[model samples]
Every structure is written in C-alpha cells, then in structure tokens.
Target: MERTGTTRRRALIGAGAAVTAALSGCSSDEPGARRDAPPSVSAETLLRRRSAALSSALLGRYDAVLAAHPGLAPRLAPLRAQVALHVEALSPTGDRPRPASSPSSSSSSAGAAASPSPSSSASPSAAVPADAGAAVRELASAERSTAAAHTAALTGAPPEYARLLASVAAAGAVHVYLLTKGSR
Candidate 1:
C-alpha cells in the first residue's frame, strides 16, 4: 500500500493547490491592495440590499396570493409575516431580531397576530390562480425559488448574514413542505 505512483486524487489535489496559490497571489497592482482579501464594506452592503429586496419580493408574492384569495389568509399570513421579518433583518441598517422564544412559540404568536385582516392591501405583481389549492401550490413554488436565491447568495456573504440567510432559506423550504402538504 506504500507505492509512490501518482493517483488521480493526489494529482487533482496538487493541481488545486497550484491553482489556489496562483489565484491567491493575484492582488491588484495598486499599492494598498491586500492579497486574497476581498473588499468587504461595499460588498456587504450590497449583499444586504439584495437580500432585503428578495425578501420584499417574496413578501409581495404572499400579499398577491392573499389579495386574490382572501380565504387563504389564515394559513398564509404567518409565513408572510416571517418574510417581512426577513426583509427587516436583511436591511443594511436594521438590527436582527433576537431569538428569545422557541420557534414553535414564535410562529404561533405570529399566526395569532396576523389573523386575517380585511385590509391587507399590498398589490400583487403577478396574477394568482383563482383556485385556492392552486394558489397554495403557487406560494410553495415561490418559496422554493426564494429559498434557492437566498442559498445562492451565501457564496461571499459575511458569516453573520450568511447564517441568517441560511436559516431563512431553511424556513422557506419548510414552508414549501407545509404548503404542499396542506393543499393536498
């Protein structure tokens, strides 16, 4: 088992190391450039803005579904409120919410608080299906897409923001399962 012949994994790892070393040294020609370090301030702000926008869009989708089919409000409102919290959390100036309560308690409280109001007046950017089950399926589809977008955004996000996005994305996936299961 001690043979010294080159293996595919070893060769690939060696090539990867060589590539990493080459890339790590590719700093800007400017005098103050830091090798292997990306600029964080502006990038972080942009990431926050983009994440907030995604949450807001998803929030709007929730609103659209509610406006089209008000009967679904009891089930959808809690999820919509969660998306609103995501918008706030992702804002550049917004402070993250404290996780003081257990997830079940917090969700139940949001559900109680968001009980179907006749005046939830957010305009729907996209048409919602008239059928209630179809509308639930549409929301599930939106949740899946939004979760993917949030997960994709984690590539270069700061660790704190990345953690938040990951949690939100996980919630979105759960929302998908709940919506689909309930619709059936």
Candidate 2:
C-alpha cells in the first residue's frame, strides 16, 4: 500500500505520542495508584522512576520507527536491542512519583500530548516512511525531547541516573545523526 506524506507523518507522530505516554505513566504502574503519595523519596528515586518512564517511551519510539520503515530492520535491529537494554536497566526503579516538573520541562514536553494517525494499525506497513528525511525529522524531534527530559531528571537524580542520562543522551545524538544521514 502507498503511504502518503501526511499518513506517514501521522503514524510517526502517533508513535512518538504513544512512547511519551508510556514513559510518563511508568511512575504509576499499579492501576489506581494515587498521584499524591507522601513525598519522602530522594531526587535519585524520582529520577529513576522518571528515567524508567523515559526508557519505555524510547522503546515505543523504536517500535514506531521500525513499523514505519521495514527496510530499516537490518540496520536498526541492534538499535532496537539497545533500547530494550535501556528499558531493562530502568525497569526495577520505574514506579515512583516525581516532584512537580518545572515550567520549562512541561512546555518542552507539550508536544507529547498530541494524538497519532488513525489511518492504520501497528504493523510492518506502518513502519514504511513516505519520505525518509521527513520521518527522520519527526523521530529526531521526539528523541531530542526525551533527551531533554533525561537531562532534567539527572539534575535532581542520583549519580547512577546521571550515567544513564549520559548514555541516553549519547544515543539520542546518534539517532539524530543517523536519521539526518539516512534522509540524505
């Protein structure tokens, strides 16, 4: 099936949104968990929780990218595995609530609230990009935003979280470079 620019964009954006929601929701893995629990956890604790969420979101991003570009399977297979590693590293500590985010983080992440495309279900065809460069830009934007969140999480989190953030930041940079080159 032929995918149009708009259709591809919708899918890409949709995938990004899904990842964001998954990451944000990680702090409350248990259903019906209270948003207003006692605030005794250290910044490190909060960071781990938030990082886990971010990790989950990034995984979703990879899933979306793969879905949009089946041809990328061979190239992206290892990257996808790396994202899984991120999730595993963050999983054990991904369920604590964080302090209220600063205004800047909130604004930067506002784009995360949008809806994805409705034209298609999640599948290999969904992975195909109508224009490789445009898809890369969309993916880059999501990675950039997630990386920013990692930076914020690092400021208030522990040294371990900082290390994780550093790694994630490096990955995001790599993703941006690859996407740009791929587009070209």
Candidate 3:
C-alpha cells in the first residue's frame, strides 16, 4: 500500500517552491513601466514650489495694501518682512526672487526683495477698502486664508517641509491677532 502521509522530501519540496515564488514577488518589476515621457517631478519639488508661490502671492497682497494705504507701513513693516522671509525660505535652493508685477505668475524670487519697479509695483488696488480699519481686516483675511492653506498642506509634506509649513502657519496666526487687535 502507498503511504498517504506527507514525506520529508515532499514537505521540503513544497517549502522550497513557496519561498521561490515569494522571492520572485520581492524582486523589482523592472520592465513593465513606461519611460518614454518626460520625467515627472518628485513630491518634494511640487510641495516646495506650491509653498513658495503662496508666500509670494501673500507678499504681493501686502504690497498692494501698503501701496493703497502707505500710512499702515509702521504697523505692517515687520509682518511684511516676515512674509518676505517666508518666501525666501520656501523658495528652492539658489533661487532669488525679483519684485514681480504678477506674483502668482512671475517665476522670479529675491535674496533681498528688489524694489518694486514702476511697471512691477503693486498698484493701489481699488479693492483696498479706503478705511484703514477695513483695510487691516482685509489683510487679516488674506493672512487667515494663507495660513489655512499652509496648515492643510502639512499632512502631505515631508518631515522638514512640514516643519516649515507649521512655523509659517503659526506666524500667520499671530499676524492675524496683531492686525485684528484693538481694531476690533
């Protein structure tokens, strides 16, 4: 009669086969990916670029408020400087920002912010409320919006980038408090 129970030879053979299959799965699938298209950017690059752009737009908004109401300078100077630093920090290594006519679209950034040239100066936007109190509120709204965006981005950012976002978001919160204080 044939033995029905599994022999050592059979068990060893099955284990060897299983390990081979598992290892095959572990090896990289080298040939299946398409490589013909332009290389895509890494997630870090995209995140940094977006953060820098946000800061740049905020800087332009500050410029607009200052242009529209120069009297607010003493109140806004330090905050604007902080924002300019944020822009610098968020920008990729070696990239210098230039004063831009259109911060959202313009690709340049600065080491020391370039004086906004005549053509590039943020005009006294009609959107700026004439009342300084109202204008401060408007600026506060912008700070709140940008801070929220930075906070939202934290989940996806790498460790270092997330830290930067967190700090900037915190600073924005403080700016909101400063601007709204006493004006309330």
Candidate 4:
C-alpha cells in the first residue's frame, strides 16, 4: 500500500512525539514511586546529572560573554571549545530542573538574556574603574567561580568530573592572564 507523503510524514512525526513524551515522563521521579525504589540510580548517576547541568549552565554564560565582546573571540575560542567538549561529555546525564525557590532560578532568565551574541563588538567602557580591565577578566572570573561550583559538584559526582573541573579551573586561570594582557 502506498501512503501519501503527508500521511507518512505525519505518522513519523506522531511516533517521534510519542517517544519523546514517554522518555520525558520516565526521566522524572514519579510522585507515587517509593522513596526507596532501589534509589533508581547510584550516587555516580546523581553526581553526573548535577555536574552536567552545572557545566551546561556555566558554558552557556561564557558563550554569552564571548558573544558580547567580539575582541575576546580569538583568545577565548579554545576555552569555549573545551567547555563545549565538557558539556558534550556530560550531556548523557540530564539537567535537573531548578526549583522555584532556588535563588539561581530567579536570575537564570536575566542571565540568559544578558549574554551577548558575539556578533556585536562591544568593548569595555570608560564607565568602569581602571583596575577592572577588559570584559575578558570579568568573564574569566565568572568561569572561575562556576568552576568552584563544579568542584563542589565533584563531592558526589563521578570521579572523572573532578578532572574536568580541574581542567576548567586551569583554563579559567589562563583566561584571566590572557584577558588582562590583551586589555593592556
């Protein structure tokens, strides 16, 4: 039997949507599930999930900064790539949805909107203090602070994540130097 092109496409789309819905439902902790249903996952799984979410959030912020300051692109390209690699490596672990009460959740949308698109070539303005340096230092500092959270994420996260955190930390330190020097 020959199916019409529209019918075939609609069938495929319906099947895909059903599969996505099923996966999304299964991924969440069910309300009726026992508090101790074999814990559903090991400590490593929890750690990996949390770490992946944190890493994704941090990288998202950095991507925004790089977007805003075009001049930093040449210098930050490698670090951004590393963050991307880290995000991909940890992506199998899904993001943990932020609770309404979480302080970070409140600012999340604002941060996302504030991130620059990289096409705009905005420089550090004279409005800021002399010691503040260029936008890169500020960006590096943000990465460093987030790296510390990644370190905290390591407490219960997989052992491998510790190494990733270390790499990010080191990269952030290098970013600080490069940004400062570039600003001079």
lDDT of 3 by residue, 1-184 (tens): 8889899999999999999999887765647645575777878778888887777777777777787889888788778878877877777664545554555542223312532222333445536787888888988998999999999999999999999999999999999999998334
User: In each prediction, how many residue pairs overlap at the backbone (N, C-alpha, C within less than 3 A)?
Assistant: 0, 7, 5, 1
Clash pairs (backbone) in predicted model 4: 67-118
What's model 2's lDDT at 97? Answer: 28
lDDT of 4 at 29: 69
C-alpha RMSD between model 1 and the true structure: 11.1
Q: After aligning candidate 3 to the native by TM-score, how far in Å is the CA of 28 from where it should be?
A: 12
Please tell me which predicted candidate would have the highest lDDT against the true structure: 3
- Model 3 residue runs over 4 Å out of place are 1-38, 94-126, 182-184
Ranking by TM-score: 3, 1, 2, 4
Distance from true location, Cα of 159 in model 2, Å: 1.9
Candidate 4 per-residue C-alpha lDDT over 110-165 given as tens digits, one digit per residue, 9 for 90 to 100: 33322222121223341222232445566666667766776666556555766766
**What C-alpha lDDT does candidate 1 achieve relative to the native structure?**
0.75
**How does each model score on TM-score?**
0.62, 0.53, 0.66, 0.49
Rank list by lDDT: 3, 1, 2, 4
What TM-score would you give candidate 4 relative to the actual structure?
0.49
lDDT of 2 by residue, 1-184 (tens): 8765678779899999999989888867667877788878775666666676666666566567666667766665555555555555654343422322453544212222111212212345435357755655766776678767776666665677678778877786776666667535
State how far residue 67 of model 4 sits from its true place (Å): 2.6
Top candidate (TM-score): 3
Q: lDDT value for candidate 3?
A: 0.76
What is the clash count of model 3?
A: 5
